[model samples]
Target: MRTLTLVRRVAPLILLLVVLAVLTVRAAEQLDNQDTYFHLRFGHELLGEWSLRDPGSVSSFATADWVPTQWLPQITMAAVEDRAGLAGVAWLSGLAFLALALTLYVVARRRVEPLAAAPLTALALVASSSGLSARPQVLSYLLVAVTATAWLAAARSGRTPWWLVPLTWVWACCHGMWPVGLAIGGVAVLATALRPDRRWDRVARGAAVVALSGLATLVTPVGPRLLGAVVAVDERREFFSEWGRPDPGDPRLLALLALLLVAAAALAWRGTDGPRGPRTLRGLRESPDLTALGLLVLAGGCTVASGRTVPVAAALLVPVAATALHRHLGDRPAWTRLEQVVVLGGVALALPVLAAVVPHTADEPPARPAWTDPALAALPAGTPVLNDWNLGGWLMWRHPQLDPVMHGYGDTFTVEELRRNTDILALRPGWRTLVRETGVSYALVRPRSPLGRALVDDEGWRVLHRSPDLVLLKPPPGWM
Candidate 1:
C-alpha cells in the first residue's frame, strides 16, 4: 500500500523524466549533421579571426557572408571541444536539452494540475522532435520556454519581472529568433490588458517591459545586423525546406497535430456554454488569461502546418495543452490504492518501449549517406572545401582543421546564397558553377548524389578516396 501510494504520487513525474531522458539519449547518439559542422567550423574561425568576419580572405567559401547568430551555444560547444573533443560537444548539447526539458516540465507543472502535467510534458517531449538538432535553435527553444513561463507568471500576478529583459538580449545573441521572447511578452501584456478591473498604469508597465525587452534584443555582438540577417533569411522562405508546407505523409507530425486539434476542441467545448451549462462556461470565460493561452495553441497549429514553425509550435503547445487539460480534467477523482499500483506498474512496464520508438521520427537520418570518407585523412592542409549542408556535421567532427564555405547557419546566409547552393547541389548547372566559383580545391560529395557519380566519371576530377557514403574529389594537376 505504501509503495502504491508513493508511485501514485510520483508516476507522472517519472514518465515525464523518462520521456525527456530518452529524447536526450537519442539526440546524442545521432551523427552530427551539416549544421553542426558549420557551427563547429565557425567556432574555430572565431578562435582565429576573433570576429564573425573572415579576416585572411582565405577562400570565397569562408567569406560567404555568414553570421553566427547562435554564437553563445556554438561557443559553448567549441569550448567543450577544446576540453573533450567532438563527443564532448555532443554530450553538452544533450545535457542542455535535458535541462531544457526539465525547465519546461517545471513551468507546465506550475500552470496545471499535477496529474495533467505528466501527459503535457510527454507531448512537449514528442513535439520537440524537430528542434533536437545541434544547432542554435536548441538554445532558442529553451529561451522561449523561460520567456513564456515568466510572462505567464507576470500575467497572473501583474508583476512583470525586470530580469526578463536582459534574458531577451541574451536570447537574441544566442539565436536570431529573439523576437519570439518579445512575442510571448506581448501576448502576456494583451492578456493583462484585457482584464476590465486592471488599471491602465499596470497594463502600460507590462507593455513597456515587452518593448524594452525587444529593443534589448539589439544589444548582441551583431547589433542591428542581427535583425538584417533574420529578415534576409525569412524573406527567402521559398528556398528553405522547413519554410515549405508540411508533408501529409509524415506520420509523427500528423499524429501530434491531430492530438493538438483534439486538445483544442476539448478546451473550447469545456470552456464554452454547452450541454453541461453556462456555469461551466462562466468559469472559463472569466479567466481571460486562459483564453490568451488558446491563442498560443492556434499559433502552434498554424506553424506546425507550415513545417518551418515546428520549434515555435513545440515551445508554445506544451503549456497550452497543460492548461487545457487542467481546465477540463483537474477535478477528476484520484486512483484508489489498488488502481494506483496497477497504473504505476503499467507505466513502469511501458516506459522502455516508448523510449525506444519515440525519439527519432524517421527510420534513418534524413538525406544522409550510409557511410563517409575519413574527412580528416584525405583533405590537404588548408584545403578550401564546398560541402553539402547535410554532411557538414560529419566534416566538422572529422576535420576540425579545414575551413568550409557554409554549413547549416540558415539565418546567416542570404536567400540568394541559399537558393544558389540548393540549385547547385540538387541540379546540374548550379553544381558546376558552384564548384568553379568557390574555387573549391577538394569536394566532399555524398555517394547518392548525381554530382558525385559525375565527378568519378570525369577525368579532370580525380577520386582520391571513396567510401560507400562519401567520395573525396581533387582537381587534376594544372586545373587549379
Candidate 2:
C-alpha cells in the first residue's frame, strides 16, 4: 500500500521531468532563424528608448510610423542577452515552451483527468511546434492557451474572468495577438447569452469583461496606434509563406484535422442513457453546449484562415476536444493534491538544472564569415549594399554601420518596396533597372543565386569576396 501511494506521487513528476528535458535540449540548439537576430536587436533598441517610434537607427528602411506591438518580449530578450548573452536568450525560449505545455495541461485538467489531458496537450504542442520559436509569437501562443482556458472556465461557472481585462493589456505589450484574447471572450459571452437557460446577469457581466479587454489593448504604451500595427503586415502578407493558406501536405495540419474529427465524433455520439431509438421531433430533448460549440466555430475559422492561425486553432481546440473524449470515455477522478504537488514541484526544481546546462549547451548565434569581415569593414559607414533577404538580419545586428536594402520585418516596408525586393531577388523583369535605381554599389548574396551570377557574369561586377555560402561583389565603376 505504501509502495502504491509512492508510485502514484512519483509517476507524474517523472513524466514532467522527461518532458522538460526534451524541450530544454531542443531549445538549446542554435538560433538558426534570421528573425531571432532582428528581434534581439530590436529588443536592445527598445530597451534604450523604451518607445514605439521609428527605430531608424537600427534599420535603414523601416517606416518612421512603425509600431512595436511586441515590445515587451523584445525588451525581455534584450535584457537577458545583455546579462547572459545568447545562452540566456536560448534559456528564455525554453522557459516559454515549458510554460505553454503547463498551461495546456492545467486548462485541460479542469474538465478531464490527467490521463486524457496530458496526451491531448502533448498532441496540441506537437501541432504547434512549427509556430514555436525564439520569437514573440511564442509568448502570444502561451497567452492564447491561457485565454481560451479562462473563457471555458467562465462558461462553466457563469462567472466572468474579469481579470482578463488587465491581462489583455499585458498581452498587448507582449504581442499583436491581444485581439485574439478579446475575441475568445466575446465568443464565450455570445454563447452564454444564446443558451436556452441563460442568466442575463452572467451574460451582461461576461460582455463587460470582453468589452473592457478590448479597451485595454488601446491603453498600451503604443496608444491607439497599436490598432493599426496589427494590420500593418496585411499589405506584405503575400511576401511571407506563413500567411498563406494551409498546405494539405503539412503533418501539423493533419494532426489538427484528426483532433477535430475526434471531437466531432465524441459530440455527435448518443449514449444508451438517451431515450431509445428514433422518435418524433418533440421527443428530442438533448441540448448541445453552446459555449463549446461557439468555441469550436472560432477554432474552425482559424484553421481555414491561414497557416499562421492553424496553431492557434489547435491551441483553442485542445481543451474542448479533451473534454469531449473524457466524457465519451466516462468520468475519472481529477489529479490528487499529491500528484499536483509532485508535478509542479518537479517542474520548479528542473528550472535551475536547465539554466545551469544552457550556457554550455546553447549554441551561440551565427557569426559572419571571418574572411569577408575585413572587406565588409572597409566599406564606408552608411554604404548601401544589396543583400540576400536572410542575411539582412546579420547586417542589421553586426554591421549596423552599413545599410542593408531589406530584412524579414515585413510590416516595416511598403507594398511597393516589398514588391521591388521580390522582383530584384528573383531576378524578375526590370530587376536590373531597380538595382541601378537603388544606387547600391555592392551585393552580398548566395554564391550561386541569380543576382550573384548576374553581377559577376552579366554585369561584369568584381568579386571582392567569395565563399561557398555567400559572395560579395562590387559593380563595375559608374554602373550605379
| TM-score to true structure, per model | 0.79, 0.91
lDDT of each: 0.63, 0.78
> Could you give candidate 2's per-residue lDDT for residues 297-382 as a string of tens digits?
88888888888888888788887776566555555466788767756875675577768877887647665677777888889998
lDDT of 1: 0.63
Clashes of 2: 0
- Who wins the lDDT comparison? 2
Q: What is the Cα-based lDDT of residue 189 in candidate 2? A: 88
Q: Please give the lDDT score for candidate 2.
A: 0.78
Candidate 2 residue spans exceeding 4 A from truth: 1-17, 53-57, 272-286, 329-332
Q: lDDT tens digits, residues 1-480, model 1?
A: 999857756777568657755765565464435567556666666766657532232234433464567777777767767776555666566666666666666656665644566666566666666667667787777777677777666765778678988888888778777777777777777767677777788789888888888788666666666676676666767766877887767655754574477457656654546687675432365443553464465556556556756656666766665555555554434444643453344444444443354344322234433334354455676677766666655565556566666565555455666776777677646466666777778778775686676666754688766777777778787654
- Per-candidate Cα RMSD to the true structure, in Å, reads 5.9, 3.6
